[model samples]
Target: RSIHVDSPPSVPSLTTSYVHGTSSVSLLYQTVGQRLDSTVQRWPEREAVVCVQDGIRRTFSQFQQDVDKAAAGLLALGLRPGDRLGVWGPNMYEWILFQFATAKAGIILVSLNTAYQANEVEFALKKVQNATDVAFKSHSLTSLTQS
Candidate 1:
């Protein structure tokens, strides 16, 4: 047996059940690239990243420099702003750099699951490529594996 309510679905009332993200701290409206730049300026020499297994370490200044170069490299590869690039890999330092560089270059970086096969990657890339509404631009699908 089914019972029906007379009234249509009503919005949740803002009482004990409703909680919001709004807080006393004012929001900082800025992009990741912008925040990175500011942090680099404030503490260029401070340690920004460290990967013991990879034997990699970078200060804020170094990280910013590398990110800039990486972003430029992406543009040089013929990927214009809004073009989709896929990066598939296990956790590594390069992932961090790509995260910032993509934002700087304005290229949309698609995170491909490390478990995805080649066909899956191709399908995902094609979806983004089609959305771009342009003739086939260069597809940069780089994969990295942890040692």
Candidate 2:
């Protein structure tokens, strides 16, 4: 009996540089609220967001104003720094508002899927210890908290 084995061929090394075509730009080290405020100050009249389906449009200044109001509302609801706030809803203007509002209010925003089931929602709520859930449609803060 006899056995024979052949050694594997060596792979050719790539001479091309892996870092080619990559570039870096210095990013601003500022909070979301600070960036938004700076942008609003720079471009007050520029359109920031427009939801045609909802017939809603807002300029940078207007959007910042709304964000402030939303932040104030969260504060009035007793949301404080380090508090978790869940935002579960389909894409809408309110979602954007909440995103900025939570950032400004220093509340951690836990985003739940719009298609999440009751169990999934419950799991997320419990996991994050969310103080409040803001759902634009169908669900409300009271309903989520109660469950």
Candidate 3:
């Protein structure tokens, strides 16, 4: 026996549709750091991040604290406002941590493609004049910085 299904009716496209987004509410322009801080302040105990693969989880307050520590470490390494920093790796807790850290430090983040080869990484680093590179596990920070 075979199951028969009827197709759903198609809806007509709206005549007012445009390439640009139209919203009734006004946009709120806020930096990532500001948003993070606000979120932590409003919901300190709320779960902010969870990495099941890594067996890691953190609340908004905990995430913010770690971000602050990472930002301070970057600052101690001589990173200043507008300095170029590169993050080259896959999606991980460390990647998320560095993302917020860079924003908090006011450093420009140059995301090096995870699929990039050695030459491509070198080219990207040169193009962006990246002063520091953050990697994970096999790609140590010392090795990346040296490169």
Candidate 4:
């Protein structure tokens, strides 16, 4: 009885490799925030953002600064990392930015559907501590309802 053994196939070597720069999540976030803030400061007169509503355009740069300030305000409100905050409202630019802001602050952002009923809102808020509801579209702080 004769048994024959076959040679294994040869594998090709990897000649090229991709290397990513050291961009830590925290560092990247700080860099982006600093860049945006610096640009806004440098071109204070220029429009940084525009809000198009009802065919009307509202210029912004100072507005952006204010948002960062407000987000920081939340950080100052004893809301530390992992703390969950709620933003209940229609889909708007502020809501999007709030998510960014929450990430920057390392806080958890729990968005609430504007169409949610009282029970839904209650359930959402009850699950987390330090939950603050922000009504940014209202333009007035009086509209803010927190639990």
RMSD of each: 11.3, 14.0, 9.8, 13.9
Taken over the whole model, the C-alpha lDDT of each candidate is: 0.71, 0.79, 0.80, 0.61
Residues 1-147 of candidate 2: C-alpha lDDT, one tens digit per residue: 332234433554657623222224444799999999999999999999998766778999988888887788788788897899998888777888789889988999999997889999999899877788877874232222221
Tens-place lDDT per residue, model 3, 1-147, is: 433334433564667634334445555598899999999999999999998776778899989888888888888888998999989878878888888989998999899889999999999999878888877765232332221
**For residues 1-147, what per-residue lDDT tens digits would candidate 4 score against the true structure?**
433334433554556543333322333345445666666677766765455542222234654555566568778788887788888766555665676567667777888888889998888788665456765665432222121
Query: Model 3, stretches more than 4 Å misplaced?
Result: 1-25, 138-147
- Candidate 1: stretches off by over 4 Å: 1-24, 130-147
Model 3 residue 81 CA deviation in Å: 0.9
Candidate 1 residue pairs in backbone clash: none
Q: For model 4, what is the alpha-carbon lDDT of residue 113? A: 85
- Clash pairs (backbone) in predicted model 4: none
Clashing pairs in 2: none
**lDDT of model 1, residue 1:** 39
- Model 3 gets an lDDT of 0.80
Please give the TM-score that candidate 2 achieves against the real structure. Answer: 0.76
TM-score of predicted model 4? 0.52
TM-score of each: 0.69, 0.76, 0.75, 0.52
